[model samples]
Target: MTILCVRFQLPSAHETAFPELLGLLEEFTPVVEALPPDGALADLRGAERYFGRGAVELASVIRVRALALHGVDCVIGAGPGPMLARVAQRAARPGVTCAVSAGEARDFLAGKPVAALPGVGAATARTLCEYGLDTLGRVAAAPLSTLQRLVGAKAGRELHEKANGVDRGRVVPNAVSRSLAAERRFPRDELDPVRHRRALLSAGEELGARLRAVEKVCRTLTLTVRYADRSSTTRGRTLGEPTAHSADLTRTAYSLYEALGLQRARVRAIALRAEGLGPADRASHQLTFDPADEKARRIEEVADRARAKFGPRAVMPGGLAA
Candidate 1:
C-alpha cells in the first residue's frame, strides 16, 4: 500500500488550520490522518484506481486544489509506508511533490543525519555522534545488540527498524479534535513583558485564523509558559461567549499572561490553546450596536481575504510588526 505524507508551510495566521486542511485531503481519499498544526497522511492504496492517477499525479492534484481553494501550498512525499513517506516529504522542496520507490527507500535514508530518523532528538543525536553513529547508514549497519547496549533495548530496536525503513505502521483515518494550539519559542530566554505579549498576540492570531478557517468557535483559551529552567505553568480562562475572533482571543491571552504575574521570569516559550470548539454556525454572538466592534469585524474580514489572496504577511497586527 502506498501512503502520501503532506506537510504544509503554514504562515503564522494559518498555523492551527490543520482541520481545514484535513477536510481538503478527505476529498481525495477517505483514509486521511491528520497531523496536527500543519500536516496529514493519506493512504492511496486504492485511490489510484479511484482517481485514475498515479501517486505523484494525485499529490499534485491535492496541492493544486489546496492552493486554489484555500491559498495553501503543500509539499507531498509518496512511499510504500508512512515512515518512508514522511522522510521523503521532509526532503521535498517547497511547493513540490516527490516520491520514493520501494527499492530506493534504504538508499534514500542512507547517509542522512541520524537526527532525520523519527524520535531522535538533540540529546539523542549528541549521544549518537559521540559514539560515531551519527548517520542513518551507520545506525543501519550497526548490530542490534550493540545499538541496544548504546541507547537502550526498546529505543535501540525501534531506531534499528526506522534506520532500515522497516516501519509497519498504517495511516488510520480520524477526525482532528475540537481544540487547536500554537506555540512560539524564543531564540533565547526572554525577560521582557513586551516580547511575551507580542508572542501571545501572534499565537492568538494564529489560533483565531485556524478556528475561522475550520468554521469553529472556541469557548475557552489556555496559556502555557515555559521557563528557562524547563518548568512550565498553564492557565485557562472561560470566555464570555464562544468566538473565532482574533481580538477576543488576544484579549483573553493577554489577561491570562497578566494573571501569571511573570515579572522578571525568563520565559523560553509560550503556547496558546483554544478549547471547547464547536461549529461556528452554532455559536451565538451578542448584538452589538457599537460602531467600533462592527468596524473591527469588517476590517478583520477584509484582512482575511487579503491574506488568502496574497499571504499571511499581507496583513498582520500592527503591534506585531516587529
Candidate 2:
C-alpha cells in the first residue's frame, strides 16, 4: 500500500478545524493533500521507508493520534494508488484500515458495483448496468471497442483502466479551502415544505453575512438534507458568478431543494456549505441595469453595517426575523 485515504468522523461544530487535521496527517507524510470539510489523501511512499512501517500500520497511528489528541475518529483505506485507495476507504468503517494489496487489487474490485468506482455517477452506472456490465469484473472483461461504443471513447478507456486497477492518478498537494458551513436542526422531524424552505432561507442569510464579514466570495453552494431515517441527500450548484450575496445563495439553495422533489420527507436537519471561496476583491459581480437589483444591494449594505454595529441578529431576513 502506497497511498492512504483518510476520512474523519468530525462533529459539525468542529468543521472549521479541518485544516488542523490535515496538519496531523502531515506529521506522517509531507505528501498530505487536504480534502476539505473532512478528508485527506496522503501518499506514504517516502514515509514507508522512513518509518519502517507499512501504510496500514501508519494508518493505525493516524487513527490513534486523531482520536487521542483531537477527540476525533477517522476511517482509512490504504492501497497501491489513489483511485484504489479511495475505493477502499468507502468500504471502511471508523477505527478500521481497509488495505488492498497490489496482488488483490483486481479481486478486491471485481465484486464491487460499477457505481462503487469513483467518477461513475448514477447516470453512467445505470447506462453500463443496463448492458450487463454491472460489476467491475464484467467491465474489465468487456471488449475495449465494445465499451467505447457504449459510453463514448474517452470515458470508455478510463473506465476500463480503472476496472483493471491501473490508476495513474496522483495525490496533489493542496491547501485547505475557505469553506463555510451552517446547519439548522428541527426540534422534531419536520415534514412541512414551508418550514424546510424557511430553514434554507435562514441558512443562506447566515452564510452570506459570514462571507461578507470575511470579505470572501463563494463560487458554489452545496445543500445537505438529513432525514429522520438517518439517510441524507446532497447536491451542489455552481453560481453564474462568484458572490457573497444572500439572494444568490438563497436562489441556489431553493433550486437544489426543488430538484430533490421531496414528498413529505421527515427532515431532521438542513445544512448549506459555501465552497470555492476566494477574496471578495478578486471576484466580480455581473453588471445589471435593474433599478430594483441596485436598490436591493444598497439596502443590503446598510443592513450589514447595522448588524456589525449592533449584533448578528440585529438585521435579519423577514422570514427569520421572529
Candidate 3:
C-alpha cells in the first residue's frame, strides 16, 4: 500500500485558512494528515478499492475538486511512505500527480539535495555540503561513521537512513487527535481586541462543532495571536474536563485572550486550538449550579441546530463582529 501526499500551493490569499482545505480532504478520505495551507498526507490503502481507481486517479479527483471549490491547484505525489511521497510532490508541477512506486523510492531520492530530507535545515545542509555531501546520494553513500563525525551521532544516523529512503513510520489512523486549530488573517491589519476576540470565538465555535462531529472531546485549549510585526504569543490551559461544547471552549478562549493583556497590541490574526482530545463518550462533565450556564448551553444547542439548517450565521452571540 502506498501513501500519497497531496501538496496544494494555496494562493497567498488563503494561505492562513485551514478548515476549508481540511474539509476538502475529508471528502476523499477521512485518514488525512493535514499539513496546513499547502499540503496533506493521506493514507490511500483502502481508498483505492473504495474509489474504484488507482492512486493517480484519486489524486486527479482531489486536484479537480480543490480547483473547482477553492481555486487552488494541488500537486500530488504517491509513494510507499510519507517521506517519499512528500519529496515526490516537491518535484511535481501544480495540478499534477507524481507516483514513486516502492521499487523506485530509493533511486528517486538519491540525487536530490540532502536538504530535501526532512529536518535538514539550511545550517545542517551547509555543514553537509562543506564535506562534499551536497546530494542525498552522497549522504547515503558516505560512511555512517564519517557522517557522525561531520554532523553528530544522532542527526547523522537519521539523515543517513532517510537519504537511503528508509521510513519505518506507519499511518496512524485512530490516534487520538492531539488538537483542533483554526486561524484567519485579514486583508488589512486591524488592532481591535474586540474584533480579535470575535474571531477567536468563531474559531473556538467551529472547533467545538468539529470535535462533536468527530465524537471527540478536548481537555485543553490554546490561543495564538499573530501581530503585524511578525511577532506572536501563544497561551494554553487545561480545561475543567474534556468537552466538545462550544460555549465551554469559547469561555476558555476568552480567558486566554484576556490573559494576553494585549492592551493595544496590533493584532493581525488569531487562532484557537482545542487539544488533548479523547472520545467524547469517555469524558466526564461537571455539573453546573449556575442557571445562566445551563441556559447558555441550551441556547447554544439551539443555535447549532439553526446553523445546521439555515447556515452558520443563522445565530450569533452578542457582540459578534460585523
Local distance difference test scores for all models: 0.82, 0.86, 0.76
Off by over 4 Å in 1: 15-17, 177-322
- Model 2 lDDT, residue 207, Cα: 79
Candidate 2: how many backbone clashes?
A: 0
Compare the candidates by lDDT and give the number of the best one: 2
Write one digit per residue (lDDT tens) for candidate 2, span 183-256.
Answer: 88999999999999999998898778767765678999999999999999999998999998998899999999
- After TM-score superposition, the amount by which residue 50's alpha carbon in candidate 3 deviates from its true location, in angstroms, is 2.4
The positional error of residue 7 in candidate 2, measured at the CA in angstroms, is 0.6
Tell me the TM-score of model 2. Answer: 0.54
Better model by lDDT: candidate 1 vs candidate 3: 1
Q: Compose the digit string of candidate 3's lDDT tens values, residues 153-187.
A: 99888888888888765555432245556676766
lDDT of 1 by residue, 257-276 (tens): 99998779999999988877
lDDT of 1 at 225: 98
The 10-residue segment with the lowest total lDDT in model 2: 45-54
Query: Number of clashes in model 1?
Result: 0
- Model 1 has an lDDT value of 0.82
Report the Cα lDDT for candidate 2: 0.86
Error of 3 at 197 (Å): 42
